[model samples]
Target chain A: MTNEIARPLFATALRLTRNRDDAEDLVQEALYRGFRSLSTFRKGSRFRAWMFRILHNVFINRVRRQQLAPRATDPADLAPSDHDHPIPDLRDIRELPEVADRHFDERVKAAVDSLPDAFRVPMVLFSLGALSYQEIADALEIPIGTVMSRLHRARRHLRTELADYAREHGLAPDPHAPEGAGS
Target chain B: MKCVEFRAQLFPYLDGELDEAATGTAAAHVADCADCAGRTAFERALEKRLQTALLADVGALDSVALVAAARRSPPLDSPTPASAVSSGVSSSSTGTSSSTRTGRPGHVLRFLTARRLLAVAAALLIAVQAAWFFCIPPFECSYLQAVERTVDAEGTPLRPGVVGPPLAERIEVTPEVLGYRLEGEATVVDLGLGETANSAVRARYAQNGEVVHVVWSDMGGAEPSFRRKREFDGRSWWVATENGHNLVAWMCPVTESLCTLVSELPEERLLDVADKLRAAER
Candidate 1:
């Protein structure tokens, strides 16, 4: 059952973990737990979401137990979008130099890496292009409102950063269009 | 909904998470509002680009092997083959129970057909047994053979009821019996008697001018009651104090011999001497 979604699941793990080795371990552990508790899986539910939920849970547990940074940092202090309101304008970004697709992808990864765990988790799950806001909320054990808020803040942060990269590469936002137009 | 509210609901509306009313309102607001429409479009494009950028190359992980491994091991929540057990047994009678049914009727038929014959046989057996054991009363439950306490002729209380010391003759010792040759002359004493009394044998071994008396006797299955006891090789040995000597005594279960070593040496040394003598015999 989990084999159907294994690659996408590993992709989710890789996105969340960043390190290839850690991602492999996370994927294996998630699959192990998924298959172990397969009987508990609801028949009509999505297996991908289920596997990702396990992966997210395992990763969060490992992070908390190891007292790793970002997770160990006060969750209350890291409340997504609670204090750090993103600037809404897309025009502040500079034009960027041309870069390869891999470079662009690496830039996106670096942008994700820059996000705090509280924002990063929901963002990664959202970007995985699979889980619903409710599913992300359920997976992260947070509220739907918190999920929306974190995602909104994450996208705003990404747009700002990526918009700057675009402009630095001479791919500036349309100057005559709306303030938050595509960069 | 206002443009600000529409902007706030942009991700929810794009993600299709808004309820019917909110979706309708947000969609209507975005459709009519150019700025909101452009913002939503940009956001949608960014989401698409994010997905493309973040889509991981996961071909390298061996998920097939992982799934196989998972299937091989029973789920932690699932009942393992090792742990599966029968829930119950049903007691419904099988064909094998015909013997029980057959036996039940035989007693009834015998009682009906031969009641007088059964009574005659029972009576004859009872009469014969009356002449055999119970009629004489010797074969009855009375314990006439039980040993009785006796006062010796010397007016001293004696344990005549004590079962035994076996009829062992005097024996000479090799140095192995003591594990060391005596520094002085050793004495072998025969303290055993015939069936008239419990029998015993003793060897007084002198080492470094210190005399240790080792006595072996047959206890005839009597439990050795000692004041101090310690366990050795899953058996108990008693250490008793008697006449300025410490006696470490134990029974050899195989030989049915109760052996005692009396030594003027301290309790530990006495036990050591007993242990060496036992080891040599082994």
Candidate 2:
């Protein structure tokens, strides 16, 4: 079981925890619990996805005691009209230019790490850990709608960083892609 | 409205968590949009590179190393302060001394004095203890001894009833660094002889030069009792105690003969040995 699922589960987990040491710990812990509860995993479903769900759950529980940053940082000025506060940069991943191409996985980790723990974890589960919005909400004990909005914003943030990375790395916009868009 | 906005939603689109219709619209936009496409591919590559780095060079695991570490004492549960562990005093001092602070305000001078006092106290406590151990000859017996206190007249001795049989002969040593060891002695006694005796009889002995440090000891169960060893006679020499005298058979090889005085050892030595501590900072 370790051999089969180790790669996918760890790859996704590493994305969440960029530090190799922490990722190894997370993978070991997640896999150990996953095997213990293998009886709960129905065989036909995607093992990778199910394992990720478990990992995301394990990560959440491990961090429950950690006081997440008080929504102290600037909430994005471009608040979605429907929300109470300005939407947090759910996908501010693109602003993580140094992490882009340089150490993509590590950048994801750093970006995720910088995210107020509240949004980062849930967002990663939905985006990379491969949990559905409902799965994320259930695992995180948050409402599904919150999971959706955070994920949406996280991706936007990621795009911002990735674009800067492309520009700096001399990677042109997808050539057949667009012109003058660098503006 | 922008390439950045489209790329932000890309991961969610791939996750299929976006509402089906919104997912389709995002997919359609990315397919036609060069900038969004470029951003997604780059981010994906970055993510892949990170995964590879995390997986690489996990280091070869040696089972012997693991087992040896596991068999040693686990880490002590207290935090050691940095000041307590400082090593290598610099060769040159800045020539600063308490008297140098003569003109400073009283509070500042007192603070410096207090720090110097603390350093002196720690140095005396630890460094002095280490020095005392190597420099001083054994002034007192390594431990106190009660000779002839509880031994019986018959040569057969009773076993000390403590955590284990009172007098044990055991030595535990491992071949590697980062290891804990327990070494040295036990004697087996027939419990039938000691049915009425509340303690075990042992002769705790050490050899210094040609003289054997021996003490006739009658010990309560399981407690380690120390007795000055007896002098060695070239041949079999025996000394009498309140209990039956212990007989020592001398041989050319002294250490082996010292061990022959006692028989059976404790059933177990130590427990809960471990390693694998997390790297943490306070």
Number of the top-ranking candidate, with DockQ as the measure: 1
Best model per TM-score: 1
Instruction: State the TM-score of the second chain for every model.
Output: 0.23, 0.22
Q: Write the per-residue lDDT of candidate 1 for residues B56-170, one digit (tens) a residue.
A: 3554546454443233222233333233112111111111111122233234443343333334434544443353223243222221122233222233443433212222221
Question: On residues A35-108, what C-alpha lDDT tens digit does candidate 1 reach at each position?
Answer: 44544554225545666788888787656544453543446445545335643545333422223377777788
Candidate 2's displacement at residue A2, Å, is 4.5
**What's the C-alpha lDDT at position B154 in model 1?**
31
Report the Cα lDDT for candidate 1: 0.49
